[model samples]
Target: MKLDEYLGVIIFTFEHMKDIPVHQLKDRANPAGFEIKYFSPGSMRKEMELLGDDVDDHYLGAHRDDHYLFFLLEKGNASLMIDFQTLPFGKNSLYYVLPGQVHHSIKNEIVYGWFIAVDTMLISTDYRNVFETQLKLQQPHLLDDKQLQQCKSILSLLLEKYDSDVKSSFYIPVVHSLLQSFIGMVACYYSQVNNTGMQLSRPLQLSQQFKQLLGRHIRTIKSPSAYAGMLNVSESYLNEALKKATGFSVSYWIAQEVVMEAKRLLYYSELNVKQIAHHLGYEDHTYFSRLFKKTANETPLEFRAQNRK
Candidate 1:
């Protein structure tokens, strides 16, 4: 099939993968740098009517957002494909999508929730650490009765502040403070579930740092020794720490990261194998294909063909 044909099919199914789009929520007039939106059964259709084509684009197709996205699903069911993995969001659960993670809604019906989009600068470092670094998978967390009541109270107050008409001097700060509280509550819940205590052991800390570095520099830096040098640890020591913390060697993670990214690109983009290889810092497309086959147990084309909707 032609690439455009492939795009249309994958646009709805993994088999017909196409180029992914990126969504952003930045407006110069909105100095608050955040937006709070409520969703219900008929709300999305109404939004499509009021907001026009942009709203449709927001709902359909695979796309990544430039800002952090959070959802508090209070009723009904919803699901989404994040980084090519399908995650189901049940009622009274909280789910977050980190910036730059490609995702698209797979299902949304009779849903009642508050959707939030906030700039990266607005999220404090500690909160970011909890949501971004500590909760790597970004899945849904079912809220207990107390937690649900707490979130509802905070959101009620926050929505009031967000829609307040009184233009006081501390208006924005108050809104932001309320928003921060809501985020902190959610962060605490996840932190407790993830068991990311206040103090991490030395080996786990090193492993966490190494994983973060691997995510950011994987395209340009692939050598285990190079990672060890960057972390200021010897190669043997780095491998030992990684194995202790994650039960995997440094090389295993490197290959895993590379293949995961490659799969994402292959399943979402129109890029050819050669271009994708070069995009991954491999000048030799042939070698990259070999590596992918070794790691994924299939050639690039085979994977694309097998997984595409």
Candidate 2:
């Protein structure tokens, strides 16, 4: 099934649960623009029950979402797997999952949380860079009591506006403003906890821009010098700036991006190894397999067989 259909199944199951009501900014008949969803603990549990024999069993396998997800666990404990990294979270913790990320619940013990799913378009490009690039190296934020309370207050207000009976014209603006504030707060905390201060130097800014561009053109542009040219900077200058800011050369980052995309396509797409290689701009399937093994410590087919659910 297509990714959207899988997401529909998950959403449809949640919509039928006892106390969880999925709120959408747009009407189903004319779905357009970014959509937002809020899920309470009761709804989450009910949806898990709808999916499998037990709540824990239901979410213990890998799955990918087509939208961004922010999960705030107010109480209890759970282990989450995102892109092969196992992240353990407990009360007062927040986890961000980007679109197309391979993730799943590894374990849960009476977990109680709130989940907000936002359409990618709804999130500003600045916030996306913060989330996808800057925050990728960090772990989940375990907020202090004060911070937790502040987040709860924002979430409560957001839900209130979301469920309000006000007219669309009024409600939309209010909720939109609140949503941006909420996301901004999260980004601030993420930056704080990750030790990457909010301010960006010129080199760091260029590094971020380069990463974004590489994400867009990774399959076609495999040369760091080409990326440097595209960014209108000399290759040596680009390398120096990137190394100073990110502790890695541009080539290392490019190779990492390629391997990451290869892993995603291998796990989520039905294309075979050769087809996957060709799709990723490799002419030789054997060379692609060798590169995948060198980067990921496993062959493409082995990785796929082990990861695909």
Candidate 3:
């Protein structure tokens, strides 16, 4: 299939996957992190079967998207046999996968879970704005039976409201809110079980709240100080908190993340430079192009043409 055609199919499957009387959630990336569309597993068996080939149900291939795979395993604990050829399985293991992480599911294990795709949008605040233990999940981690039950409850609530036709408009926001809430719950559990005490850090809490707000308002606001003012904190305090939590300057992180969004639009979207610049909140295309080059080491036109070629 052609690229656009395939994307169309994936997009379609993603949007209506919940309406199909299956229990699955499939989402596409606007950039690399946003779950533009998703549905429950019960509403997506056929697509799962078809995509099982692309994703290969028992295979080791990586997801093409740059989002983390948040699987809430809800069944028998099967072993994942992986490696150069084949490897032995580990018992009673639950799985979480970040983008670019390597691993695969076990074959014929009949594992049940919810898969989520997160969109990488502009980050108007510092990268250090959040402190959930799950956010620090640099690698795949395991969830236990209790955590799995919590996740199932979250999904069940989502499917209950989202699957119905009378409340279609509220579906998207409800799902998005629930995903965030679910993450918050998982983060809380990770913090409690692990006794990490990382979530209680004042700086981390402020930083994460800022990050969530930034995700929601990336298009309009792009300044660290602006976020600080909005969040009722001084710019210096905000910057210090973020720096203490994430090790980078707030301004640098914001600019870099915003640039990442620009790259996504320029590469995956057909928007012109001016349009892309406007989409990213810049009035001048020249400035946006310059920022793009500064961050990515290539002019917008050159970057798009070379990569999209």
Candidate 4:
């Protein structure tokens, strides 16, 4: 399918996935600026039964969405493709799909899960940072039984609040709090699983701060040293902290971030290579093209053409 057609399918899936009728929510005008869907094992099985053969043919195809997805699988198993990486998830595992990521639910073996998709604006920057930065480097966590129960409890509460009949002034705040708690729990698990008992340290904190700073200033401040100065640390010290925390040097991260942004602009925007380069703070377009090729193994035009969807 074409990009627009596939995006339409994604939109339809999100809008109709809730157990409740879509018109009810639309009539009430959702105040939370996001939608939450709950899928119990029974509900999932029923839906799959209803879909029948279409499930294998349609749901397995690759598609992209504009919202963030957080999935918790309490039982059963499934395989999924995120970007070009195929990941198989089993019972008691949690995974996330960020916006603009091309993903496909490759196969399911009686899977039972809860997936919540929220707009980027509704998610706190701190929680979003966990997914955007840390989770990108780590695989999905295989949640222990205890963690699974905790997450299930939170999701249950969220579902209850989401399906509540009474809509009060406090409804939105309550839902937001519940969502934040759920995301915070997942982030904690993700960090603990990835770090392998690594204690939080000054260098780790500095590394996180530098990443946040780099994200905000990437278009204007291209230099690692400038990022270091902004964080009130010397370039060498910042590099040391980042290396210890993330296993990559500061220059590597900056280049990676820049190339990622360039790829986004190329895929989503109508900008040409030179315009994208200039917008990304490169004075010399040829130099920017070379850098992109070095980092991405493809020229800007080639990447854009290949990833236009």
Question: By TM-score, who's the top model here?
Answer: 1
Model 2, span 107-162: residue lDDT tens: 66665566666777778876875776561444788889998888888888877777
Candidate 2: worst 10 consecutive residues by lDDT? Answer: 1-10
Count of backbone collisions within predicted model 2: 0
Winner on TM-score (2 vs 3): 2
TM-score versus the correct structure, for each prediction = 0.85, 0.79, 0.51, 0.68
Better of 2 and 4 by lDDT: 2
Arrange candidates, best lDDT first. 1, 2, 4, 3
Clash count list over all predictions: 7, 0, 22, 0
| Better candidate by TM-score, 1 or 3 | 1
User: Whole-model Cα lDDT per candidate?
Assistant: 0.74, 0.68, 0.51, 0.68
Which residue pairs clash within candidate 4?
Answer: none
lDDT of 4 at 23: 19
Per-residue CA lDDT of model 1 for 1-309, tens digit only, reads 111111111233433544556566774115678877666666546434543443222235676667788778888887777876888877898988887677776665567778778888888867766675441366689998788888988988888888776377788889999999988887888888776656767777777788778878988999999999999999999999888877889999899889888887887777889988998899999999999999989999999898764
User: Cα miss at 235, model 3 (Å)?
Assistant: 1.5
